[model samples]
Target: PDILHQLVKGTFKDHLVEWVGKYLEQVHGKTGTKNILADIDQQIAAAPPFPGLWCFPDGHNFSQWTGDNSKALMKVYLSAIEGHIPDDVEHTFHAFLEFCYIVRQNVIMDQTLAELRDALAQFHQYQEIFRMTGVCFDFSLPHQHSMLHYDLLI
Candidate 1:
C-alpha cells in the first residue's frame, strides 16, 4: 500500500499533469499549460499520504484509478481553462487537494464504521459472559476514546 501510494503520488501524478497540460494546450492555447502543469505537479507531489487508518484494498481495480474522483479532478482542470472554474492554477490545484482530502476522510470514516460494527459483534458474542458475571470484561477505554476522536474528526 505504501509503495502504491508513492507510485500514485509520484508517477501517476506526473503523467496526469502532463495529460492535463496537453489537453489544456489543445483546447485552449499553449500559453499557460507549461506553468499550470508545473504547478500541478509540484502540488500533487507535495501533498501528504492518506491517513494510516485508511486501507486500500489489495487487488487490481481499474475504478480505483479511473473513478469519479479522477473525473472530477479533470473536470476542474478543464473548467478552469474554459473559465467556468477560477482560472488561477492554484484554484485548480486546490480542487485536487480537496478531492484528496475528501477521499481520505471517506476512507477513515468507512474504516471506523467497520471497526465499530466488529466491536458490536464481539459485544454480542460476550454478552452472555457479562450477564453471568454481572461485569463487562472489555475495557479498552483508550482505544474507544481514539475511535470517538476519529468519529468527531469525520
Candidate 2:
C-alpha cells in the first residue's frame, strides 16, 4: 500500500507538471517559453512535500478528513498559476484538485469505493478537456514498468 501510494503521488506530480507546461506552451506560445520552467518550479515548490496521507504523523492523523490538505494543495497550485492561464483552464484545474481530494482521503468500505468511482469519472472529464486542448501527458510509465517484472506487478 505504501508503495502504491508513492507511485500514485509521483504520477500525480509528473502529470501536473507536464499538463501545466504543455498548457502554457500552447496558450502563450513563444513569449511563454521563458516562464514555463519558472512556473513549473514555482508550482512544484508550493506543493506539499509529501502525499496527503504522509502529511500526517505516522499516517494516523485524520483531523482534516474533510480534505483540507487536498484543498490547501490545490490553493497552492492555483496561486502559483494565477493570471497565467485562462479561467476555463483554471476551473478544469479546480476539478482536478477535487479529484485529488477524493484520492487523498483515507476512508474505507462503500464510501471509499464511491469516491474512487467519482474520482475516475472526474479524471475522465479532465482528460477529455486536456485532449481537446492539446495538453498531452505520458502517465503510463508505471504501468509499463510494472508489467516488465513479475514481482513488481500491481
- Cα lDDT listed for each candidate: 0.38, 0.50
Q: Please give me the total number of clashing residue pairs in predicted model 1.
A: 0
lDDT of 1 at 122: 44
TM-score per prediction, in order, is 0.25, 0.52
Residue 7 Cα positional deviation in candidate 1, in Å, after optimal superposition:
4.4
lDDT of 1 by residue, 56-137 (tens): 2221212445443344343334323343112333333443343334435435667655654454344334333322432324
lDDT of 2 by residue, 1-154 (tens): 3323332333334455456667777877867745665664455464556544223232212344233443334445565666776665566566556644554466555665565456545554555555668775443565323312312221
* Candidate 2 stretches greater than 4 Å from native: 1-9, 35-75, 87-92, 137-154
Q: Residue 127 of model 1: what lDDT?
A: 30
Q: In model 1, how large is the Cα lDDT of residue 39?
A: 51
Which numbered prediction scores highest in TM-score against the true structure? Answer: 2
